[model samples]
Target: MHGFIGEFFGTMILILLGCGSCASNSLKKTYGQNSGWLFICLSWGMAVTMGVYVAGMLGSLGHLNPAVTIPFAIFGLFPWSQVVPYVLGQFLGGFLGAVLVIIQFYPHFKESKSEEEGNSVGIFATRPAIANPVFNFISEVVATFAFVYILLNLGNFTTGLKPFIVGMLIMVVGTCLGTTTGFALNPARDWAPRFAYTIIPVPNKSVAEWGYAWVPMLGPIVGGLIACGLYTIA
Candidate 1:
């Protein structure tokens, strides 16, 4: 129960701040309206840092991402029994956070009138800069492989200062590999929030881009599995 609670709230905060940063930039007439990619990456890094801190302080290892939880469980680093609860919490938290983001920027949603004008699903989920499915999947796979592989080395990263280190790692990944697919390294981060956008009635909303959703969801999980598989060997 403690682990579940930690994951729930931790993921909630993570998505709240991370997606909030996107809304800030994507929405019209916002103070952060053209802050650029570095700004978003920096904010997302800090968002994960803060969320991990919160999750650690509460309980659990701060596995707010299914990419982390599922792979760790496969390697016996995490209890298999807890996998369902942790994943549920992560997905649910992400949905709530995205809902909050919608409410947070209601006026902006009303103002942005079309997909071409910043009302696209890219604000809530990822889209490939170049629309090739095969390459996009490869991008997500490689990016998540690097992230989870390094994360595997930092055992129990929820410990003090380590969360910050993880944050820096995320920032670097975003700056480097994330350029192609926006680095949707976690399934929960992309899928749940994308679902929220699809269902929720955000004014002047664009397509959910469900067609590309599989790339972020399946790609991260596969990458994490590969990372754990190699880690066990090495």
Candidate 2:
């Protein structure tokens, strides 16, 4: 129960702080050029670090994202039988985190483009300026590959420093690719917030693009599985 709750809470904080900062910065136009990516990567990395420190001791540290959890299960780092609980915890926690962000940003909800405020909200939920499913999935696959590879290698480091490296890697990817697809390396990070965006009111907001949403969700899962398989064979 502790592990499950810890995962739930930790993931919530991860998305809320990391993605929340990205959304707020954009809404306010406060960041300089490329600052959004930098902010997101930094925030996400820091969130991971903090979440790990808090829950690693309790055994739920690695389940912070489905990308991490699913691959771990594939590689036996996490038990295959337990995969369902961990994923469910992560998803639930993420939804809760999105709910909290909505409450925190309630005043700005009306300012959003949607005429009817939806339930979910966050900056990390990516919406392409233009729809390009193939390119988007490719971007997510590449980004998730980078993320999981770094986790496979750097995960051995001391807990205190591991998160920083993770953050830096994310930062680099976002700097290089965030403009096109928002560089959502984690499925939870993208969908949890998008779920919120759908329910939250934004004035004149565009409809949810379900067609493009699956790319990030499936891409990262596929990328993580591939990396884990490679790791096992190596």
Candidate 3:
């Protein structure tokens, strides 16, 4: 119960702070930029690290991402039967968190517009810098593979460094691949906030870029399978 709650709350906080930095006006003043990819990546990485640290002690895996949960189900770290419940929790957490961001940015809602060339990109979802699906998919695969590989290998390292290493790995993946697709890498991160962007009454926002949403979702699932396979052989 505690573990599940941790996952639920941790995911909410992760999306709230992580997405807030990109969407919320106040947060942007503090951390946003024309190329704010680094801040987004590091903030999310640190968010996950802290969320997991707090939740892990209570037996929560702190997945925070559907991609992570899906792979765990496939690999038997988590049960297939539990996938829906876990994902439901994650989605709801993410949606609620985005609601918070909406409230935080309520005053700026009317100021935003819906267009590729304007501030719409900041309030809405992200797209690939190069706009090539193949490269974007590969970037996600590599990022997810590295993230899962680190999580798997953390058992071999000192307890104190596990979080740091995992967090740093996420940071690097974002720094390297973030230019493309803003480095979503996590389905829950994208979908949850996207749902809010679509449903909530925000000014001048387009549909959550559903056309490109699946890449982030499917890419990590594929990447996790690859990671699991590599881990199996290792």
**lDDT against the true structure, each candidate:** 0.91, 0.68, 0.69
Which numbered prediction scores highest in TM-score against the true structure?
A: 1
Candidate 1 off by > 4 Å: none
Please give the distance, in angstroms, between residue 66's alpha carbon in candidate 2 and its true position after superposition: 1.2
lDDT per residue for candidate 2 within 184-215, as digits (tens), equals 77777777767766776543445556667798
State candidate 1's TM-score: 0.98
- lDDT for each residue of candidate 1 in 1-234, tens digit (9 for 90 to 100): 878888888988999999999999888889999799999999999989998998888887898899989988998878999999899989998999899999998899899898766787888899999999999999999999999999999989899799999999999999999999999999999998899999999999988999999999999988999999999999
Candidate 1 lDDT score at position 82: 93
Residue pairs in clash, model 1: none
A best-first ranking of the candidates according to their TM-score comes to 1, 3, 2
How much lDDT does candidate 3 score?
A: 0.69
